[model samples]
Target: MTGWARSPLKSAAAWALPYWTRGEPGRETPSDLFRVLYLGWAVALTLKVLGSSWDVSWHFKWLRDDLAPPHLINTVGTVIVVALTIVHGYTGYGVDRTALRLIQVGTGVFLVAVPLDLINHRVNGLDITSWSPSHMLLYIGTALMIGGVIRGWFVGAPEGRTRTVMLGALFLFCLENTWFPSQHQEYGVFGIHAWDRGEPYAEPILLQFAADQMGRSVDRNMVVAFSLPAPDYLYPVYATAVCMLVLVLARLMIGRAWSATLIAAGYVAYRVLIWPLLMVADFPISAVPFFLLGAAVCVDLAFYIKVPVLRAVVGAALVTAGSYLSLNLQHTLLDSPPLANTSAIAAGGLLLAVWLGGEWFVQRYRLRGQPTGARVSATATP
Candidate 1:
């Protein structure tokens, strides 16, 4: 046998026993095992992200098919996730008990959600909105699953470039999912504009179905309702309240100087890369949230504040102001909607509250007089 083949065989044979033995819970995993296991998770999640990106665009152009190519791509990722769950469950190698339970429950919830989603579609015929209850369940399950993986990787993987890179990548996926629902409006604006200009982006069947749901004919009004169902205020508020929150958490979790900026940049870059590809494929494209980079920069800067409470307060304000400006800039330059004054104020106040609450939780959770950085580092690889 070749030395290359022999080496892997030897490692696998050696790995088998401890894997089956289910060694002590929360036990320290070997660095090599940790790398391989978490890297698999990273790849699996990347596949899921790509599939979801395509799935959203696909829905805009075609009716929901049970066996669509995007669904098949997602299914492949789910299969890998299931296999990894089994390995983690049996081996206790890469995860502690709590992490294992999270993975198991998340996987179970996701599995259950799949059938429910199909049933939802069967009953409601062509429910394409990603904000539907069934779809939310899927997103929730995915969040839980990603949370478990994050916990596992954060605790298990030794501190290094590998750990930093993996954690950052995971945050990017999380941010994307967090911002996903907003795409409805982002795409809708463009779709409506295109329809007005003599070229409609949606297929006739899709427009017909949506119109039928509202007892209306396929016209401009129907198109407006079908495409831009959400209120304009929601987009910016969500950007601050939900998506920016994720970036804040990423900054905390990744524990790097520019982690938030890098992650946000990565997300925007991915969107730009796919935008042309989707256009070439004749699928609908949405407005990319370039403003996230501004907020992300603020998130990173927020950490430099020495006092936690003041930091959260000032940081929230900064993110809100910076992002609002960026949103306006994007609206002027891109096909995005104008930012509302009410949304900016509401977003700032809400973000401040959440940021303060998060700070209190961090302070209370730590041992007496323990430095905040120490507490943060305990959950993250520095």
Candidate 2:
């Protein structure tokens, strides 16, 4: 009886694997169908970043609406992924079941949170930070899903144009996630004064405290609470730490010259491409973080100068220091009121510490397995 019961269970699991993994009714190696489907998924995810940014901007600029353009863009992007998942089940080309199943779990969580977000907006209103429960869940989901896709490519992409192009896509996606918080923060700081006059959205209690501190009555609409200069180090410190994580991981995996440059170029391209578009659309704005190119160059050069552990340390320090000094100086010299003082030494130290911890973990996991980038050099990338 036990043997008969176990046999069916094993059969069921084996039958289900291909729907979530590779090997389908078509059964082609990196099948064209698979690639096309993945391409669609990647496009959706890329749009998600843009849509998410627009959504946040919408919150800052206008009243919260469930079906707002920003929300619709983001939601439809996610829905596309969900739809693709269903279509893949029918079409026999799933999105890298080869990677962590945790990503699927994340997507499920994100779907559940979608409706909850409407409830959140209705009750609490739009938020500026990623700390809110719904927002955090959303971030966690996309990050996991993107990460799984990257992992799947690393495991599956062949050595040729396919690998190169997909590698660039992965780098761009990683850099987008790494630098997005900084972009959002920049928009918040500048737009607070420009597009929406120090707008009050959420956290009235905090605004009330600011009002009390100023010896004035708290008016709900008046943005008197947010006019003060934000802490200059918050964005840089967090951004640098996250940047170190992604940069080090990608460099380790790819181990190629100009790996950091690839990410930097993608970031710069997006800013340049989108800045004009936003301008044409009459959206409020300021200059991009063009200084990141200098910072990314420093990290890339450092990777060439040193070996594994030392290079990691040096790259982390260089990236953080270069970004802090270059971007902060540009902001201070160009913008009104200027940004608050950035703690270069502290940010660098923080990134260096985080990178070192990550290095130890990588070694523990044996992830440095004989330089995949060297095997990959035969294939060139843009």
Q: What is the TM-score of each candidate against the true structure?
A: 0.89, 0.75
Error of 1 at 98 (Å): 3.1
Alpha carbon deviation, residue 53, candidate 2 (Å): 3.4
Query: Global CA lDDT of candidate 2, please?
Result: 0.61
Q: Which ten residues in a row have the lowest lDDT in candidate 1?
A: 367-376
lDDT of each: 0.80, 0.61
TM-score between candidate 1 and the true structure: 0.89
Error of 2 at 380 (Å): 23
Winning candidate number (TM-score) = 1
After superposition, the stretches of candidate 1 with alpha carbons farther than 4 Å from their true spots are 1-18, 361-382
lDDT of 2 by residue, 95-171 (tens): 33433354566677778887786688666644445545786677667667776566545544555666666766776
